[model samples]
Every structure is written in C-alpha cells, then in structure tokens.
Target: MTKATLQRRPLVKQILANADDNLLVIGGLGSSNWDITEAGDRPLNMPMWGGMGAPVGMGLGLALAQPSRRVLVITGDGDMLMSLGSLATVATQQPDNLAICVLDNEKFGETGNQATHTSPRNNGPTDSGAGTDLAMVARGCGIADTGTVREASQVAQLVKDLRAAKGPIFRLVKVMVEKLEFVMPPQDGAHLKDRFRQALLGHP
Candidate 1:
C-alpha cells in the first residue's frame, strides 16, 4: 500500500480495538481520507475545514481526563505548526497513553496547496519559508519518544511502537499531497452539530 493507503487503512480496526479509548480526530478536514470517513461515524472526531491546528490541545484534555485510556489524535503538518506550543504542554504533562499521529503532507493541501512551515525548501534557511521539521519540533518540545515515517509499510510498526511507548508519542508520517485540494463547503446548522454532539457523548 502507498502512504495515503497506509495512513487510512488500519484506523477502523485500531479504533474498534480501543473503543474505550478517547479519540480526538483534529486538523485538516480534507488531508486525511480515513479521518473523514471514519470521523463521520467516529464519536470523538473534531472536524475543521482548515483549522490546521488544535487537536493536540483537545487530545491533551481528553488524556488528562481519563489517563488510563488512550488518547489518539489524528492531526496534520499545518495543524501542528500552527499550534507547536501545545507540544510543550503535552511534554510537560507527559501523558503515557497519548499518541499524536501527524499526517505530514508538507504543504497545506486543504487550502489551495500553499506551503506551510513544515514544507522542505530548496532555498537557504534564511530564505526558507515554513521551515519546520515536525520530528525536530516534537523533540524540541521535550517529547523524547517522537519519530517520523516516510514509508507506507512502516505505519503499523510505527503505531505499535508509539502505543508501547511511555509517552506523549508523536508519529509524523510523511505523505505526498497528490490528492489535490478539496475545500469543504459550509453546511446548515443542527445537522453537523447534532451529529457531533451525539458522537461526543458516545450516544447512538
């Protein structure tokens, strides 16, 4: 499977296995396909058009609330960069069961494919735009168990490693933004909110 397939492929099973786990799917609505499909039915998903950041903070709250259960956060490159400071908070709290999966596509694919701080650069550091390495940032935030994966096949192993870790683990999985841009059109009130509320309370 390719990187995109890998990022999405095993989520359902994992989510089901850890049903009791508090899942908070945050950041980049269109970046991760698994998150979108799984989120429609996922109780803990926090959908955002280009919110880009905020999942980690929410995940931290959930993790602190119920430390025993896992807090899985599905976020993106743009999301984390915008809220890199949240990592400092997460590292300080050091929630053992928390796992942050960053679907790193380099650019802000959801918004006209503009470059984010994480995108690699051909120019020098001074000339570089959005010069941030997620792995480095995670480590800099004082998270020692952070790692990045560029291959699709390594996803399961990476997840396993992160799960077994005594962390606050950050898994930055690099993906190619070949899917183009897809902006989510605004919807009417009550429909999305009601579904989200139902999901948040874990009701059918």
Candidate 2:
C-alpha cells in the first residue's frame, strides 16, 4: 500500500481557507461531506448525504450553468471510481470553470474501510497487479490539467490550481487514513438545495 502522509481535515481547511462568493463547492458522500463541513459549511456548500457517484456530474452541471463561478467537487476515491465515466463526460463538455479533487485514502472509508480499487494490489499469484491512477485516467479522458499530490509542499500550488487555474482540472490527493470525528452539515437535502440555490441565484 502507498504511504499517504497528509491528513484530510487540515488539507480541506487549506483548500477553502480563502474561499469567496464565486466559489461553489460540492462535497461527495461520506468523509468528503464531513471534510467540507468541517472546513466551514456555507450556503454555497452543497454536501451530498447519500449520492455515491453524483458529485462530479452535479459540479459539471453547476459549472455549465454558472460559467462565471468556480465549481469544485471534492470527493473520495471510492466515489470517484464509481463515476469514472463522468470524467470522460466532463472532458467532452470541457467546462473551463469546473475542477475535481479526489481525496484518495486507498480505502473505502464509508464502507467498513475496505481496500478500494485505488489501493495497489498485493500482486499475489492470482492478482491482476493493476493499479488505479485517477489523474492519469483524467489525462486519458483528454483533461490536460491534472495532477496527483502526495506531499504537503505541493499543496500551495494545488490550492492555486484548484481556486484559479483554467479548468476542467483534476487532482488526486493522497491522504492518510485516520479516524476523525464527523462534522456534518444540516441533514435536510431540500434545505441544502434551496440554500445553495438561494446563495447562488438569490432565489430558491
């Protein structure tokens, strides 16, 4: 298994440290939902309570709808793997304002900490020995701006790209697996939708 040193919460905090009105964030289900909420739950923040593979698609639609806003989708590796095909769709659409960051812990945190496909295989006698590289997958999907961050030093640049770089950009951040307290947003989905709509459009 790859040794991921960066912690999730601090990294998430840094990502949204200077967030502004034009920045809209979509947090995927499970840990990502908690991470963004921990960062600071705002009207512009929409944390998915149960949608496993819908964050990217939602972010893409938001980007297309609001061309002037920066739309960032923060999701887990397991969630991203479930929607890999969405990368191709995003590539095809090529929304310049859209960006995706996959927080890869190499384990499915919401599902009993199972090793995900992103985890490197042990290469046993029957193992396929295939490894998942999300950034490379994005590149293969025709996304020119893509990166994988494994060190704290690279985070400053990663933040820059996430906040201001021309996109559609894709980033995979390798984070350490540690049990953290859940920081949840308001539980109602309708409230979240209405709140986000009002924040973005001045109407619900």
Candidate 3:
C-alpha cells in the first residue's frame, strides 16, 4: 500500500474513456461510485449508493444476461473484501465478458479513512503484520487472469485487459488515499435503476 502511486480518478477515467453501448459498468459503493460518476455518468453506468459488496455480483449477473456485451465492475478494496466469496462464484460461472477492477486505496473511505485489510500492517504487539493480497485471493479462487497494478506505467496494459480482455478478469489497482470531491450521480436508486433499464432495454 505504501508503494502505490496511481490516482483513482484519472485511472477510472482512462478505463471508461472508450465506453460504448456494448459496455456496462457497475461502480461499487463509496468512492468508486463517485469515481465512475466523475468519469462520466452514463446510463450504462450503475453506481451503487448503499450496497457495499454487491457490485461484482451484479456485474456477473449482467454479464450472464447480456452475453454479447462487456460487463466491468469497478469497486473499492473495502467493498471487495466484504464479499471475496463472490470471486469464487464468478470464477465458477466463467463469464467471458465480465471483468472486475478493484480500486485499492487500502482504506475504508466512506467510514472515515480507516485502514482496510488490504493496508499493510506493522509487526506491532496488536497487529497481524501482514496485508491481504487481493489478486492472490482471486487467483486462488480459480481466476487465471488476475494482476495488481502498483505503478502508473502499468496502467496501459491493465486498461487493455480490462476493456478488451477475455472471461472473468480480476485486477487490483493500488490507488493513493486522498480527499477528493464527491461527484454524485442521481440520488434516487429506483430512478437510476429505471433509467439504466430504459437505456439498456427499450423500456423501463
């Protein structure tokens, strides 16, 4: 976590720059929801308001439902940790169009910048002295296409994999913890869902 240099906002923007009708994005709760909104709040982008660990699951379902389209789940480390088991389900399903990109700031951003499990711990009397590796977890859960992006230089390849890669891709992007403005989407969940349905389908 200490060695991370990439900023989340720009990285997120890069990921969604080429988003077309064929792409469906699920932004995880908290900072990622705002990050995706800042990138561009399109109908194809479903930014969660309160669901902490449901983005990946939603992405999986969407990918299954729309096999021809690409489904990307952009989530935070905190949210990912809450439902690491979902990775196993995704791997089991093996959706070719589903990709998960975890924005690991190593902190629980919404609940005050508290250290998440992904944050490195010191060998102190009260600490475990170990940090969880999410990419390893994904690999262990049967996902072959998994990687961690710590430096800005590696983002280009990561973006390629995210946008145009094969089935069940998992990536962890280590981002810096900084206070950024919240660029919110529509506050109403039903309204957002209905709009998304109307856009993706011909009716809501």
Model 1 over residues 37-65: C-alpha lDDT tens digits? 44344444545544456678877887787
Residue-wise C-alpha lDDT for candidate 3, range 83-126, written one tens digit per residue: 99999999999999999999998899999899998887886566
lDDT of each: 0.65, 0.94, 0.93
Q: Model 2 over residues 38-144: C-alpha lDDT tens digits?
A: 99989999999889999999999999999999999999999999999999999999999998999999899998999998887776566866568999999999899
- True lDDT of residue 25, candidate 3: 94
What is the TM-score (0 to 1) of candidate 1? Answer: 0.74
Name the 10 consecutive residues with the lowest summed lDDT in model 3. 121-130
Model 3, C-alpha of 97: deviation from truth (Å): 0.2
RMSD of each: 4.5, 1.3, 1.4
- Residue pairs in candidate 3 whose N, alpha carbon or C atoms collide under 3 angstroms: none
Q: Rank candidates, lDDT, best first.
A: 2, 3, 1
